[model samples]
Target: SFRRSNVSPRFLHSNSTSHTWPFGAIAMLIDNAYDPDVSAKQFWIDKTVVKDQDCLTFMDNGYGLDLRTMHKMLSFGFSDKTTVKGVQPIGIYGNGFKSGSMRLGKDAIVFSKSKSTSCVGMLSQTYLEKIGAEQIIVPIVCFDQTKSDKHILDLMQ
Candidate 1:
């Protein structure tokens, strides 16, 4: 069984306001990738035009997140990270992804691929508002290469 709670979409913008400086928000995201659990040695940030809209992309060769982890990342107030190999993680509040991402834009799409799975998740204030949603909603899909589910395949494409 799954339990549900209601969080207004407007919270995204209000929460992001804590980031007075955009650079600080970007640093929070970079710290997440550099954290011990992800241990990313390389990270790339770029800006490109998509459908005539300027967009930013961040990529890292880190240990990618699974569905469960992705869910936790999108949710508020959940952090299970601990010290690893004498290295400490910088994101302790578990609010970085939301605050940082929403500070940069109204929408964000995350693509992560672990050793055996690929996942996609989206956090979008624009989407919520357009749909007249009262509560925040995040849609996530995971694809396991070993399985051949048509629905999953469609989502992957």
Candidate 2:
């Protein structure tokens, strides 16, 4: 956790956050977050999925790449609010933005069109690497919501 007062140089040495890892390390993090045993992709695809009309537009360009730039975006309404109903705080790690950076690639362009006008979380691995960070991001772009069920079983892996 970076304190508001002291930045980097000092923050790097702090105990709260001290683990400078390479880009390859991110792959393991993502795999650990999600499971390979009991899969849930099919359930999510069949249940929560409605139509392709649920993606909200977003510039997955890492939501901009710097602290000032990202903060500016949030201040300008890039981090929209929406409903979050997952498990009862079980596997929920409470930080999707960070997770997205690794899975989406260092420089990804994400575009979503969802049902809600205010539901978004954009992350860029390229920018995160510059700042020394990463996450298990999964920005799923629905391809014809109608193609759920067995179609997704093959896509889950």
Candidate 3:
């Protein structure tokens, strides 16, 4: 279910931490999609007809996360916005991506495409549990040509 990639980061979990909330995951999706560069576009939430799929999707025409930004998103306490001297962005603490995604499902599939490139990344709590790891591993892949088939999409770029 994950693409072959050389880059994967593991975030350690501690026994004393309680890191999930019922609404925080959904909130993260909305908050990240806010403030698009383009105007006259709206965000949406909908259910898909795919069988056995109970997940809800939040989508918008907002600027999507690039590979670099996506990597930072999965990392604990890593926010590029914090480095900007005069810029004040909301929730610069950077715990939202990991905690929120983990809370939402046993795994998360993040897909984002920029003008020249498209990327896919997956974070699986089940894999972490099976390995008895305190860390979360995110597998990422980037490509120029898009594949129509899901299985072929897992091939290395």
lDDT of each residue in 26-119, candidate 1, tens digit only: 9988998999989999999999988888899999999998888888888898888899999999998899989999999989999998767888
* Model 3 lDDT tens row, 1-157: 9964432224333311244554766776665555222121567877664468566666677566656766776656786553234434555666766666656556667787766557777666666677765545667776654444423333321
Q: Tens-digit lDDT track for model 2 on 1-157?
A: 8754422222212321222443333432333223232122322111122253232222221112232223322222233322235422222332333333333233433333323211223444444455654322323323333443413211110
When 1 and 2 are scored with lDDT, the better candidate is 1
The true-structure Cα RMSD of candidate 3 reads 7.2
TM-score of 2: 0.25
- Residue pairs clashing, model 1: none
Estimate the lDDT of model 1.
0.88
All candidates: TM-score: 0.90, 0.25, 0.65
**Residue 1: error of model 2 in Å?**
17
**Cα-based lDDT for every prediction:** 0.88, 0.30, 0.58
- Candidate 2: deviation at residue 50, Å? 27
